[model samples]
Target: MLRITAGKLAGAMRGALVGNSTRVAAVRSLHGTEESAEEFDKRYEKYFSREGIDGWEIRKGMNDLLGMDLVPSPKIVEAGLRAARRVNDIALAIRWLEGCKYKCGDQMATLYPYILEKVTPTLKELGVPTLEELGYDKPELALKSVYDQ
Candidate 1:
């Protein structure tokens, strides 16, 4: 809360601060290595498949999954979908698929099919319809203006 300004006082304060500084340029690794993809998958799968998971938790988990830069592994996606099913939110599950599609970018054509292939059996067992089945593969209610037509 103290602000030392100008002249000799400022110089002395700056010197004291720098001398007492405990900050280090080198930081130690907590785990010494990054989490392996398998560890990441198991962690998220456990997170979504925990007992008594609710809609909010499912949404939170989905948001976390989407926020990550990498496309989630199929097991993680299946676990999240199953969590959505546990909460009885078909809409959320569909949105999760959309997020996954967004995460896949141009690779969707290649990756999504495989993701679907992996999760299809689970989707059938859960009775959750995909965005395509719900008619969301195309934009909703496209109207061509007469001027443009």
Candidate 2:
């Protein structure tokens, strides 16, 4: 039987509400490292199994979110940043920044500054260039820059 570790039904619901097909495809693309289809299925199965939710429901929810054709709001981006900060997870912080770049183009100029302020120290500690230096023009490129650095 599946069990939800997060105990946050709202998170799952929100995920469903925002998980559109496009976003799902984007997420899949984000998993760029080569992995077999079986591996991907296993990973998703584990995710759904742990969430105590039906896989189809989750996929449907993702599709619904994608249909909205909206990027994540600033509020969501801020929340993700806060979470990353709290966890001291640089990779997660970078991921959130990348998401903000993808979804909030209007706020890109402002967002980059904010992310730089928060992530710069971490990046320096990890011997990576600032987001501005690496250039946040492309999410995939930014991710690679971070990974390569």
Candidate 3:
């Protein structure tokens, strides 16, 4: 006979298997507790630091972090970049780093520098370039647009 479960345990398992953040969040809230920012960042860092993480998972992880409301910690960014490098994806790695800077928003002036300070060594170690270094910081500088072709 097949068994069906609609209990909290089932929801937890489903949340884990489905990788649905909303459902996972609902389950946590229903339990009267939510993860702290540090815990959240640590969890993501651990996720990204997993061995044998493929390109799809790396992109998915970056997208998940980007979709979040808060900016990721420098350690998390470093971990993600390391993962990206592991998957041989320097281009996507740069994009993810840029996404982190964009996430800084109004705090870009203050917080971005701190993130850069913390992650600079890792960036250099991984040989990942920032948008500015790639001349992406000024897209308007392009002499010819793709539309002009």
Candidate 4:
């Protein structure tokens, strides 16, 4: 099960919803899956549309749960990474990293580890740091430098 650290239940719910979406997508792509493609599409479409629920309302709820007075992309990325790690799913991690790359920028470096480590070693050869960098060598201070500017 995925765990969310955000104070609000809505944030947790959103995280779970997103994680489930990812899992469903992965399962459908597996070879010789038991679920029919049509069935998988129907289920995913229902969740994607937020049918009975208001999509904007859920977005608002997530905003409130974040409590940072801004849409916290970092928090979302952290949650996704944690969920992927919890499931021991590298593909999920790659998906989450791709999403982060889209949001943060392709050259952001931090979001490219999945590609670098698994797909290619060029980044490591170039001396790029992985997410582990955020946990080492005065990370809080380094992060503050980015956020403070």
Candidate 5:
């Protein structure tokens, strides 16, 4: 399950990663309001039932992963797949992985091949950019700090 995997991944990366768990807060900010678990679930189900999800949804999910500030592991991917399978929505799962890629940035480089293999066809049909195409195939290490004077 995603919860289990997320927990383990978080545990493994707690000291190694650099982001914060701001999804809950970010969600509330993005929505301009707080939502209860049931409310969120209802909204999520409705969103998933649509023919397609928008970039905002994907970005929000990515922000959540970014908040964790950890690189993704294979187990994390498996957990996401399992969670999506529970809903019988393969596209949604792929979308979630896309979000993971954006959220984790270079940290997801190792996952690009696996993710591409799984979602290439669907993404082509859907006209979504592959992670590699989007320039996520490698880490983007800055040569200079933004604060450099």
Candidate 6:
């Protein structure tokens, strides 16, 4: 079943009137085949928008990308890239990276470079020193240093 956490729903809801929105809840499908990413997002917003549904138990899960078994799916990586390009929100990019790092575990190495490349400009805009500025001659070393921090 496709499930979504209330926190992710709230993030999607953005400026909606999410009273006590910090709480997390998981909504799952009872039956029927999993929906497409677009359809799932539509349904998730619809379910979360309804009145009530607060203080529910928060289960670990991801949003959209039904076919994906991995945490840092291409959709998520793209979303982070888009955020970096448009909003340039360092916190958002970092949160995405942290989520992937925490959930993807050893698999994160494969995706880390792509994420770092996408977010580097935003990080620079946010005054985070680059690898060159930090005296790291190599991007991989700089990535490790930044990841460690």
Clashing pairs in 5: 20-67
Q: In order, what lDDT does every prediction score?
A: 0.87, 0.51, 0.87, 0.45, 0.55, 0.46
Tens-digit lDDT string for candidate 6 (29-78): 43457768776545544443334433121011223322256554444454
Model 3: per-residue Cα lDDT over 32-135, one tens digit each: 56789888889889999998889999899899888989898998999999999998989888888899989999998898889988998998999998777787
Which lDDT tens digits does candidate 5 get at residues 1-149?
99999999988898455344565556667776676656654554444344544545544543454466454443444444444544556565656666666665674456656655665665555545544565755568858768899
Best by the TM-score measure:
1
TM-score of each: 0.75, 0.31, 0.72, 0.25, 0.32, 0.32
Q: Which lDDT tens digits does candidate 4 get at residues 1-149?
A: 23454457778799999999999989878858476655644543343235344434434433343343322244344443444444455454454444444444545556444433452342233333444443432246444456575
Question: Candidate 2, residues 1-149: lDDT per residue as tens digits?
Answer: 13464557768877787878668889888886896656644553344334334434444433443245455443334434444444455565565556545554677567656655665555555544434565655465334455575
What lDDT is reached at residue 99 by model 6?
57
Off by over 4 Å in 2: 1-68, 105-130, 136-149
The predicted structure with the larger TM-score, 1 or 2, is 1
Candidate 4 lDDT score at position 95: 43
The residue pairs found clashing in candidate 1 are none
Q: lDDT tens string, model 1, 11-76? A: 998888876663432344333678899999999999999999889988988898888789999999
The per-prediction CA RMSD against the true structure, in angstroms, equals: 5.5, 20.8, 10.6, 19.2, 17.6, 17.5
TM-score of 3: 0.72
Residue 53 local lDDT, model 6: 34
TM-score of 6: 0.32
Who is ahead in lDDT, 3 or 6? Answer: 3
Q: Give candidate 5's root-mean-square deviation (CA, Å).
A: 17.6
Off by over 4 Å in 3: 1-28, 142-149
Candidate scoring better on TM-score of 3 and 5: 3
Candidate 4 backbone clash number: 0
| Runs in model 1 lying further than 4 Å from the true structure | 1-33, 143-149
